[model samples]
Target: MYGEGDNQVKALDEVSLSVNQGEFVLIVGSSGSGKSTLLNMIGLLDRPTNGTIKIDGVNTTTLNDDKISAFRNTKLGFIFQFSNLLTDLTVLENVLLPRQIGGTTKTANKDATDLLKAVGLESQINKRANKISGGQAQRAAIARGLVNKPSIVLADEPTGNLDSVTSETIVQLMKSMAKRLGQTFVIVTHDRQHFGEVDKVITIKDGKAFEGEDDPSTASGKEMEVVA
Candidate 1:
């Protein structure tokens, strides 16, 4: 909600959905459809005016700012459309940034290395972020997002900046990694091709959410009950 009186607006109106552990969920909607808002809510970046968000069985709505920040740092991971890596830092260093901020650097070195290797960025580990290609940079970003071993990883149009082939590759890599690590992924993307790979597809319209079917093509017509 924003503004007052005549200018008041509800960004999200009773939007509800559930994401099971180890599930690959895709969120699709047009611009200004509240897709990002829902993601922000699930990522704990923003709190709702009403209702509760339970992640890994923890009710985040009741946490104070300090506790929320700590919980977010430890339980939530994010991958954006842009890699947003530090240009001056090496790939390895960028991946370890979260751990450094969280004061958990003891085993982070090895964990970061392993994540980079998993994402096929091991060869570029020592290279400066500015020197890597867009795909490599995004891969590094993926590695960075998983460095903390967060409960769920939230990605916003991760393949939006890549070519079709690169986009397919990136999605496959994400899916494979998710399967191997048993990590849950909630991604917001415009690419319909990704629907085939995800465990669930959520469509957001006018601040409302609806669950889709298993088959991507037939998902639009079939809607499931929204879970609060």
Candidate 2:
């Protein structure tokens, strides 16, 4: 809901869904279909006008702002389209930033290094963020997102700024890392090709959510099958 009375627009209407532990869930929708809103809701970045969001059995809507922020820092990780790294920071430092903020830097150095290695950015760990290529920076961002070992990771068009090849690589890296670390991932992407290996596919339309694939006889369904 964005406004009052006639100006009100319901970005999401009765949209309900769930992701199991270690599940890789993909959310897709055409423009203005409210997929991002759904992600924001699930990510605890936005509170719903009417409804509840439970992450790791905690009802987020019930928490105060301070508690919400604390919970978010500890339980959720995020990767955006852009790497959003500080130019002056090295890849390793950038990845350790979150741990430092959370006061959990005791083993952060080792954890960050291992995550960068997993994302194939071990060689670039000492490079300043500004010196890295777009793909390498995004890989570093992935490492940063996983540094805290959060329960769930939320990514919004994480590969939107990359080329097709890099996009594919990033997606695969995320999937593999999720499986290896047993972390749940909820991604909002426009790339249909990602449908191939996900545990679940959720489509958003007219502010409503429809889970699973469409009818096989439908054109979109056929396309999904071919992509998968």
Candidate 3:
């Protein structure tokens, strides 16, 4: 539905693609290339003005806000640049926050503890979220994301605020869990230095996506049959 009007921003144009249930997807592009908009749509935080978005075989635009929120609570996870962990809560408490929104806050303590341990933040569980370092806080956020056991994890520049070493460490850690849990991940990032090992990279420019491994000046791979 993106064509010709002033209100129309071609955030995603002719972008037809599908990501598998257990794959790691890297979305790379410089700023204003619709990377954030694409992630938001994929994460169910925003709806596209045109085009269909399906997650797990269900088109998301048809779902109402409450249904969408409930679906996301159970089927998707999110990690972002800022941890967004509550300052008044402890690490464990922050990890348990999603449960509150999903109305399962009563017995989620055990699950929160497990997720915290999984993210290597067991020792920091009792510490206030605000007291942790940026890296540690992001780890706690990771724990929070997994608390609901979503099938897919969407991260928008998850390491944007950290040093190179910490960023590398955190990315690997998150990927390890994503692999072990058999969950899908859509990562939107500008850090080209960490591209070699990515499973797949899709580059977007002026709202159109160039599929396959990230290659500029080469033919776009969109016409090729995508396996997933």
Candidate 4:
């Protein structure tokens, strides 16, 4: 991207990443390091400036916006730093909205309440979206995303709004749920401590990805590091 003709920025340059089912991957990068840009590309929120993205092993750049949106609704889930709940609606209503709009499920209401319970919010089921803590709101957002049982969940700063302790709890809850549902998770964050549950942590630097050996920074580690 160009700030001006004389000052252009290569937000993401030749970055390739591959994720498999039931894998929890952490993406770490400081601000302006193209972390969110990469996430946006993967989330199908925006097309890449160059290169291509494949979901379910199908190339996506050639698909129209409606097709991409449909694919996203059916195949991918999204969690942002903010919960983005509809403040006027109840938690259950907010969670059910996606399925209702997409015509994906006949039982979104029941699924919403069940997901709320899973997130430790059974009593808050009827609570208005504005009446919850940040963590609770984010949990409700999680429920919204999973209402479709998506194949991949892309989270951009999923725990950015909460305190460190709450962030840990929230991340762990997500990890446990991903394991149970066999969902793939890709999370972007600047903080590094709470990712002990992640399978791998890939770092972005200078418009490219960090590549090294083991996650312990060793070459002999069993897991192959992908970002380069």
> Best TM-score goes to which candidate?
1
Evaluate model 1: give its TM-score.
0.93
Please give, for residues 1-228, the per-residue lDDT of candidate 2 as tens digits: 889999999998777776789999888888889989988888888889987888888888899999998998999999999999999999999999999999998988999999999899889989999999999999999999999899999999998899999998999999889989999998888886844778888787778777765322332331121000
Question: For candidate 1, lDDT tens digit of each residue in 121-168?
Answer: 889999999999999999999999999999899999999999988888
* Regions of model 2 farther than 4 Å from truth: 214-228
As for model 3, its CA RMSD to the true structure in angstroms is 2.3
Which pairs, if any, clash in model 3? none
Clashes of each: 0, 0, 0, 0
TM-score quality measure for candidate 3: 0.91
**Residue-level error in angstroms, candidate 4, position 193:** 0.4
Candidate 4: what lDDT? 0.81
**Candidate 1 off by > 4 Å:** 213-228
Which model, 2 or 4, shows the larger TM-score?
2
State which candidate has the highest lDDT. 1
List, residue by residue over 1-228, the lDDT tens digit for candidate 3: 344777755677766667878888888877988888888888888887866788888888899999999989989989999889889989988888789889887669998998888888889999988899999999998888889888889999988888898898788888888888988888988775753476667787777777755554573656422322
Model 2 poorest 10 in a row by lDDT: 219-228
Candidate 2: the clashing residue pairs are none
